[model samples]
Target: MHIIQFEGSSIIPISILTTIASSLVGWIQVKRYSELSASYILTAHEIGVIKEQASYVSSESDFSSFIRDAETAFSREHTQWIARRVANRKPK
Candidate 1:
């Protein structure tokens, strides 16, 4: 009876330790995911703004304004594409 009681008590500490470790790992993963998701959302928003600006520029007939807006939009789109690629890369 004494030996069985001792063994059971030992397992309690191990179980508690494992649970704590797992919880910490889970929290880290959640934090990382949230950060990544937020970054993606921001990039999407920037792209949307650039697209809207380009549309507005196109509606106008000034060649210089049109060229500037188009160039800005193109640069923004390229940056968004790069961000997407980086975000999707597999963790080493």
Candidate 2:
């Protein structure tokens, strides 16, 4: 659609677009979306492993261990999320 077309001065439009793209990328990094996604993926894998262990839970102790491990995975993820939020809030 070329809504930002500039007649006879193409550099201005290109420069403006570059600046906007850079700013958007910078904002995404500052928000740490990638790190948050990694954390989620790791947590999901840990939970999946625990679920697999559930099938073999034949004793009370085994069930207790599974629960503890599952809770630990959840706590670790929550702790990381809280830490990231706190870090972002700190003055830079």
Candidate 3:
């Protein structure tokens, strides 16, 4: 760790406070990362399920309908991602 400049002799409390703030920031980042990872995993799992359902369609019309629904779901997910990104940006 770098030596922090203390104007007077009150270095102990400042150093402890700095450490606590850094730890809190790190914890927040880890929580956000886990949440994002879960989101991606869930989206991928949904795609797999959609594919399985689409595979069971015996007619072209049914397959087309399934594809349309999958596209709509993907679009909605994209929109949600964009909204989240924007909201996060606004705070920062």
- Which residues of candidate 3, in runs, are more than 4 Å off? 1-12, 90-92
Q: Sort by TM-score, best first: what order? A: 3, 2, 1
Name the candidate that leads on TM-score.
Answer: 3
Clashing pairs in 1: none
Write one digit per residue (lDDT tens) for candidate 3, span 1-92. Answer: 44556687544556677889999999999998997888788889889889889768999998898988799779877987998788689553
Give the poorly placed runs of model 2, Cα more than 4 Å off: 1-31, 90-92
lDDT of 2 by residue, 24-82 (tens): 98998877877788889999999899889999999999999989988999999889988
Best by lDDT: 2
TM-score of each: 0.51, 0.66, 0.72
lDDT of each: 0.69, 0.84, 0.82
Model 1 earns a TM-score of 0.51
> Candidate 1: global Cα-lDDT?
0.69
Q: In angstroms, how far off is 6's CA in candidate 2?
A: 26
